[model samples]
Target chain A: MKNFFVIIVLCLFISLQAFAGLHVVTTTTELAAIATEMGGVHAEVKSLIKGSQDPHYIEPKPSYASILNKADLFIAMGLSLEIGWVPSLLTQSRNAKIQRGHEGFIEPYQGIRILEIPSGVVDRSGGDIHPEGNPHYLMDPRNGVIVAKNIAQKMAELDPAHGDSYQKNYEIFAETMNHKIGEWQRVLSKHRGLKVVTHHQTFSYFADWLGVRVLDRIENKPGIPPSPGHMVDLIKLIKKESVPLVLLENYYDPKPSQKLAGETGVKVLTLPVSVNGVETVTTYAGLFDYIVTQIVGAQ
Target chain B: MFTARLMVVLFCLCLLFSPTLVLAKKKIPDQSSEGQVLLWKFNQTGNKALIPDISLIGIVSGAYFRDDPATVQWPNPTRTGFNLQAAELGIQSVVDPYIRADVFIHMLEDGLEVEEAFITTLTLPLNLQIRAGKFRARLGRENTQHLDQKHFADYSRLRRYFLGNEGLTDLGAELSVLLPVSWFSELSFDFMQGRNDVSFDSPRKQDFLYVGHWANSFNLTTNLTMQVGVSGAFGNNVTVRKLTQIYAGDLYLRWRPHERRGFKWETEYYYRSLEGAVATAKEGGVTTSMVYQFARRFEAGARFDAIGFPEDAFSQYQVSPILTFVATEFFRLRGQYNFLHTDGAGKKQHEAFLQLMFNMGPHGAHSF
Candidate 1:
């Protein structure tokens, strides 16, 4: 049994050595998809958490460390989106190459203007608050442009041999994203000022960009379960606002949203906010395509 | 004493409730002339030197059960009253470029003791990791986890029969080698002081206990994963009056669909292959548990335990149903009921418990 494992490890190493592309590991599926689009042939990207998983609640696994150990570049949403799991992976991987603020490290929240950052002293009572701005910035297509550009620049920095190719790939991604943003805007234009209740705080960025009014969240805080009092309050507000829709994501329990929808006869729409969040949604553009299409069609 | 205990409990509740209650119920304000809503991000630099990622986890439990107090065997006994399960304080930080430190101390009613204190070398070549101080030895699945991390209120029947209150931890170090495989795989070899509360250590023989573990997890698909491992340990038993050997196998299967709610089934089996002179003969048992997350923050699980009842003629079998409610990542409340029946004497026992756990401060990620 021991020799069998050694042979397996040797085989895997040989197979891995065959690929010379730069190894880039990100903390989220949305980032991984964007890295792939921008890195093109120059990089190989692996995300620590699948799109289906909540980035804030990622369970740390030993295998994550091994994948990070070999990474040439590491990407995170920053603002502690991956705080639950990523830091421990970096510590356990012992990979000096991808430590925070290092050349091999890239954080994408730099260019995207952020919101919901508490003005005064922040505490957990704020409901699993992100001391940084909202890390769910990817829900907005415009922010995807920033992520793409950052990923490509980081790739070029780490693998300078293919710097020009990365630069060219990034320009294409940026142009494509800007065009898609215009198209998505047109599709979602009718839903402007539509009132909706979200399951978590994550959809705030999406609502902010699309002119949707976020009436309330089933979970008042990021990770806190909705207290009965809170839910009753939300139901009252939704009735008062006459909110037409209740928005839920693939990673949240639908019961709370369903109960809310049931209370006021409001329509419930479940959407995947990120790539790989659903099996049908597999790319950066596909994420927006699925979400906007669902919202517009449901209306 | 009652007043002091009540005060302590109130203090713990305050610590648990303050985060949400203390904050002003302010809206995500409308965009102002500043362009974005709010500009206050976490001061990244301020956290570097002083904070050091420290966390304190406290678990308070009260239970009532129908078991003879004198013959109590479990740590969280089936006593007909309240007990403090454990209070664990964990401090972790990266010491330098080459090493990091993790320390966990248990504050019990009797005294305070270091649960685990170890410095790990992270920069070793060949994917090798080394820890020089006492750690929760990477021997088996249940043996490695802390008390609060468990799904059930008590240890499994096998663990209770073999290992007592403190699991299989000794003042020794472990060296782990990460296999360079596509899947997650690790092999660990530990050499610890041949001293355990279970008398699995030879008090007279100046020797060390050896434990070996090989574990790996594989993603079957996007929503499903399976982890399996085999572990073995060899040591001298002073009370058993003979050299002792133990072998164990564990399997964990999980199906999580898009991170919302999921199902998990885990089982472990162990065999005390060698017999001790004064102790009972060969004993073996298996524990199997299945849990389903029916709703967010809510989970229901059932565990079946059957273990050889040493020093007696009967083998004990128990079925426990547990309901867990996670109020936050930091706070959890659980209710559990256990029904136990013996084979020979046919003695039946019933136990019920309410356990509350709260964690304050920042904690490093734990092994999944």
Candidate 2:
């Protein structure tokens, strides 16, 4: 019994020692990328969902709760992006500091300009709609700036000792991202109002950022797979609109878009929508760079 | 006993209907969207965000068995035809920042029952949580879960033989503490009224069921996880000056590479000792299952269950193979075949079942 108690005390001490700095946990990799930029060694950051995985269908694994239990700050792209999984983890985490409405919990959608808010009766018939708004705002570089600033503000609030450091890091990030956004806009300037086809509505914010016109999505609804009738309609729409590109997320299957390309002879650009989605795209800014490069190459 | 059951039913009924009555007084505007309209109305109504998440799940099955109908279990499809197994109505809501309430009303062909009703504490310190009211004891991996949440369509023979038909569910208070460890470790203790007839039943009010569980899980790798748990329950028996003790151990291993594909293997073993005035009866059993998600929405699994040592006179073993297809998150279809053999009776039985389950309401998160 003495040995057992001694071992438990040792374990508790080791556990407490593990949190040497502010621990930040994010729901998606994009949020982790931004948090990392803002934290700048003052905070240790981890993401629950990898860039390769679809955020819509994450299982609330118990191991995630274990991670959340130790998190000093939890950030998510709110508007119910993680509505399916995050709530249960927050409750199971048993971390009073990271519960909803607490300072440790951050949802960075307050300053974002939301889109796709339904104006009529909303139900599952619309294929897993987010009644609040679209949650893929990070795809837009401008929104990335807003989220980075929000995360920096929250990190400084939680770790006031590193307040000046976080603010400095945020200004650096905002300046670099602003320059990159201008460069990307110039690169895609010729494609303004360019009609493109996509697999899902994941590119809504991205298209909104560049003045690109989305002809129609291969998926008839948000999450539902395309039907034969819908594919027929899309083919006619693409033909009539002279759509030049079919943009597909790297994580999605390319068969449907390939078939659409075969039907329309359009260039297909399978792009990474999140950081670390591909081997070369490791940073948040690199994600947009890769998308622009793919679009320019396809054109 | 009848009056007490009636009173509980009436209380649950009141909870189930009160939200609709409260929402009826406020009229929703015709032009506003459903999501914003509800929020607007809640703001207008002042402190009456009374609409809780309400969901209904219905399970129906068809079975064909080559065994005596009388020998079949209560929950398993007894008749060689279609069976309306169960319909469950779940009402859940966060009562406040500190508390969340969940109530499940089960409707069987025979009667209505309040399956579980409990309130869980949200803001308890020391990484602790408390649940009060009637709830299932977390004695083993599968006992606390509802039928729909289970991997298989039917309960394992070991659980049925050891924990009774309904399992270890009763009026109880459970306190769970998330231990300060690097991995996921949780310890829970439950205190309940000793009312289960099969395992514990005492007229004395002082006699209570006590249960303790220690669960620990480790992320062995990025794609693999393993969980191990041990649990024990003690209570007074129906006989004078008698006692009942039950012990259980469970293991779960999962390898999930991504959302679409994964494999899970789970095993649980249970031992029970019932003390009578004359002698003590001891028995033990084990159940093991493995499920593999081969495709996006399809899973195939098999389970093996045995309820006695080879030397025991009364021993039974069963083998089940199951296939499941999930049309969506809210709908599922499963087919299973069970082969059973009893050594004492020298009898062999075969059963096949096809089950359909559907759910509707706001998407509720499930425990891992």
Q: What is the alpha-carbon interface RMSD for each candidate?
A: 8.6, 7.3
In model 1, what are the clashing residue pairs, if there are any? Answer: A125-B19, A125-B20, B240-B277
Q: Report the lDDT tens digits of candidate 1 across residue range A1-299.
A: 99999997678866364568898898888989999988888788899887777788777766688788888888888887878788778766756567553456677665788888786877787878888778889888888887777677667756789988988988988888899999998988888999988898888889899999997888887787788898899889988988888888877778888888788788899888778888999999999888888888888
**Model 1 score (lDDT):** 0.77
TM-score of each: 0.85, 0.88
Per-residue lDDT tens digits for candidate 2, residues A1-299, read 99999997887747754557789999999999999999998989999988887888887878899899889899988777887899888888987667765557888765678888876887778877887778899989999998888788778777889999999999999999999999999999998998998888899999999999988998768776778999889889888988998989877768788888899888888888888889898899999888899888887
State in Å the error of residue A274, model 2.
Answer: 2.0
Q: Stretches of candidate 2 above 4 Å error?
A: A1-12, A16-21, A228-244, A258-267, B1-50, B71-75, B310-313
Pick by lDDT: which candidate is best?
Answer: 2
What is the DockQ score of candidate 1, to 2 decimals?
A: 0.30
Scoring each candidate complex against the real one, what DockQ results?
Answer: 0.30, 0.32
